[model samples]
Target: MTTDADDVRSFDQRGGAAQPKALSAIRTIARREIAEQLSSARFLIIALLVVGLTPLAVYVGARDYKSRLEDYNRLVAEQQKMIAGPAGREVKGFDVGWSEGNDLAVLRAIRPPEPVSALVRGLDGALPQYWDFSPTGIVTGPLASRPQRIADVVGHLDMAFLMRVALGLLAILLAFDAVAGEKELGTLRAVLSQPISRAALLTGKLAGGAVTLLLPLAAAFLIALISAQLFGVDLIAAGALAKVVMLALTAGAYLVCFYALGLFVSSLVSSQKTSLVVLLVVWVVAVLAVPPIATMVAQAASPVPTSQYLETRKDALDLDIRRQAELEMGGVYREITGDPEGNADTDKYYKNKESIDRRIVPIEVGYLNRRRQILNEIDRDAERRAANQNRFASLLMAISPAAAFAGAATDLAGTGDAQYAAWLESVRRYQDSLNAALFDDPPTVMIRNRGASFPAELRKPPTVADLPSFAPPRRDAAAVLSRSLPAIGLLGLFTGVFIIGGFFAFSRYDVR
Candidate 1:
């Protein structure tokens, strides 16, 4: 019984000619395996599934992006109009007049939809697309559009979803019977008796099967890009194109993880049926069960307060501060006018206006400062808790290669939590800028005089250009790649573990 090692050593003794022969053997086996997989009914079915579903997913995602973009544009226009007044000339039809009391009225900042979300809609759909800033506090706006209830159940049809679910299953199907079925048919013994080493045989099978599995995926990717273009999604720009390429590479790595896992299972089992059943169960657990269960566990373990609760608390705080300020101002008014009811005669009121304001303005400024500090504290606490919960969920979900792939894909596509967080930080900066522009100086109470009721400085409306505009932060490719590294590393780790396991298991596999 000459082993493959003995055959290899004998060939090595023949003047180093064995290297080329072994390479030829591996190539031959790879080609044969590829032909077999391409001719199989299962391959055809899976190919059709990829080709048919990818474009549909792209279409749905593109339509959603368009709708959100429209909403974003409309909101931005409204915000600009509200700030600059009608026709940018006069303050006609404006809700808030240019008065001291109404200086810090509601201001808004809108986040535009990411163009790459036409392929992967991650936290983009879930996170608020706008924020409102006011004297009281910042408020998160509602989602640009509500997702269908069915989408909550079935999930969004996007490239990430298809790669995680459909392509993962295809990888499993293609590799589940690679070694076990050959053994069952007694073909493994005949192949092992040939001049090829076991390592070469395994390498050939892996190469051949990967090619078979990835060809359909490539075609599906092409179709998806084409569909995105047809629907007016701009994925061809240099930055977006780079992200798309990264996404494609991430998908390839994810599928390879499943393929290697299936091959390892096939080598470990004695029968093809047993191998397939085992791989199917693993696939279900990894793809369908792990991500949601991780989320549930994370939520249960690290609960955060709801947005409504925080909003209510801030509202209550604002009311308390306002009531306190009013009481103090009333006391000041009585002291200045020597009227217990603070109802001084018009002549007396006009005469003491300056004196009363000097006493009352400090009270108003102090209360305003107190209110902002308390509200900002509450917001920081909420954000910290939410961040902790997200980190925990991400750690748990990393157990599933599918989830890892989704994370990487979404991050690259600029639709992930990282991108959303960046958007939020930008909005906060804009909020701060707006506050400085409107309230840097303490506004003085203006008494109605015989000539003008409003301040002479505010006679003309301020144009939109007068205010600080929001400049959305753009993440360069390097920054996005850095953010995606953790998930990408997890995927690579999964692929390595499965490939090593398959090689080790197949080395001892019995074909008798």
Candidate 2:
């Protein structure tokens, strides 16, 4: 009994879903967003500059990597020559042929490895290269040396300059016109009057804006890759490529976060100009003004003294000579194989030896222990101060998207302060290994003039080549990733909140 008109009416009612229906509509909006920026002369100029300079920077970084590799090779050759030369004479008079008067025992106790092991691509290296002198982290033992200069260059081009500056700028530019510009053009009320839901309208705009902002980053990454390859740096490792992809994604997340932040401020404020000013101020305080100040504060709170000062302090407190008398008595007993009273006849020589041993052993142990203690104290103080800085930096990350981006990007690059501190820990472990090698025996050898009939070979300590090189404790990349999760969580959380807020705010906005 239903009429044709009723059937048509029911279909029409079903079609009223409170959203944009066609894929074409979303594409149209996204296209508009990108086109708007492409038409801007200022943005065009900036994009061009970023494109042109990225390649140049990569080339310079590659050249620097090459130079360092050459230097490491030269250092290795020099070390080999030194080991074979006349200067590498052995010491005598000690239990192990080491002389007591010479610190050659200490020198031979911790022989440095050939510098070639530290270089990337030295005389044609391979992948998974480990960098030397990385205060953040370094691989220990013999490993492949691939030039990480590509990582550095790509990181610099894509993350530091782009996310912190370029994309941030673009976000501000897009947001400046988000609401006010529409109102100024007298089309705000017209757009709001449509039957479309407010949230849908806002979602469309934000989607559009994000597309515009992220395109440049994508372009930059592509161009940077091509340019790096030209400079003899191949960052084509799976990990490296994965890292780059994550960086781009991170950049996009940052763009949306900042754009949302700017839009929120813009909506709350009365004028576009004021909103732009506020954003610029926030950017400067969070990105340009904060990290360096934090570093300075940390350094001041926990100072790092020079090695010479530590050495001088150690030398001035010579406990060796002070305990010499007891050592001499002890030595006499050992030589005579009896108590001090039983060796009374030889007490003079025994006492003298005992005194020297007492003076030397205690002073050396004390010096080493005290220095180690002082260094530990300094390091703890530094860590404490860094903790304070980290807290403040975390706060900045919450308030400013630029800070979040910087934190994420640097964390990815393994260039942040935390990573650097971890690297220091590895080096300290290596030093401990060196200490163990030195103290394995009497740990002290005395150098002496050759016996009248002995050859020159009998007068010197063992060759430096005989000693073992220091090896740092190994690090797990997964562990590093786990440690960084909190920062990542913070950034990811911020992005999520902004995304939700952006859609909500845009939907509810009074366009009129």
Candidate 3:
């Protein structure tokens, strides 16, 4: 029986056909598929599920973001005061270097939480918020945030949550029946009996379903962005909007990939029930099983120090620094005056005050050199180990697209490794400047030059006004895009491959 689809196909198959006809056929199928999906109970239930869950994620994220923002501002303010010398002016007892537990240096390495993290929070929330920067440094801070529950560890309600969990499953559910379901009911064969090409039909169905899925997401996304503003997130960072757009695009691509996978599976299978079951299993493995397995593999492959261990080791190193400083200081006194018990007893040392005084300056100089050498080695080793662990983790996640997206998304949002590097580099430079300023102006040496005694007060109380202010480096859109550009390209390539595979599979599908 000749039908309208058949007539359209006949017209196109003959000389009347053109690119427009092909596109029209594709669109015709797309429109019908879109209508069918929109009217289905499945679509309604999934859309409602998305709407119901998204707000909780937003609320929690917003609250966390606001608190962090406030913390960052206050931290910077307090550091500024210390640098200006108002806060640390009357610090108790004698001044010592940062390596010896002296809080003299106001240099702090900080990668503040990204404001947009409220919508798409990633690994940054779990990374160290701040670390003390010193010339001979022992930095101690949290590696990541501690989650209160299993849900916090498994997943949060941010955009990444939706991208990885909700939309991923939704795509599969929507498409698992796209071809096999129709074939089971004889609709696929009837549609194929028309003149329309199989490839065209598949293309239309996939495109139409993609649009239908995206429609609800687009609305939800708009609402989330609007909520971001109302939640008082800082949106003025360079390329903030650009980063959000990139992440949104990533989520869209991720969603479409799953949809295409579902279609591919449907085309391969004969029964819709079988297709759905197969796709669901695949979904569970891809989204759930792989990432954690990858993480465990990474942990075993490249063991990392626990935060407590790091903190404890740093404290031990600090104690060693103190002990070494005193030992060297005393060694210099004995070497100069032939007194092994030099300065151990202040009253006895005062018995030969001039002798002790004469050696004090040189003793301090020797002690500093010894302390700096030891601590530099410790710092270098710690950093190398941490870097190796981070690299290992990055490599293991290559197979897991969700992790890839989260890492890339976090980087784009200024809460990933890039920000950490930027923060570290900024503080390192500041520390260098501080060290230069400190060495150039030895307060005690200046006092001694003026014929003063040891431990003399500084003429200026060591104002940080002379030191250069540290501006935490922020990655612009271009830099962020460049860093994750390779990942983005790879993801797109994968999606394209899946799409092409779907087309080829459908072309060979048996309508019988």
Name the 10 consecutive residues with the lowest summed lDDT in model 3. 445-454
Instruction: Show pairs that collide, candidate 3.
Output: 126-144, 126-145
**lDDT, candidate 1, 447-469, per-residue tens:** 32223332222234444466677
The local distance difference test score of each candidate is: 0.78, 0.52, 0.69
Best candidate according to lDDT: 1
Q: How accurate is candidate 1 locally (lDDT)?
A: 0.78
Ranking by TM-score: 1, 3, 2
Give per-model TM-scores.
0.85, 0.66, 0.82
For each of the candidates, give the backbone clash count: 0, 19, 2
Model 2 residue runs over 4 Å out of place are 1-19, 22-27, 72-159, 293-399, 437-483
> Residue by residue across 192-216, what tens digits does model 3's lDDT show?
8778888889899888988988876
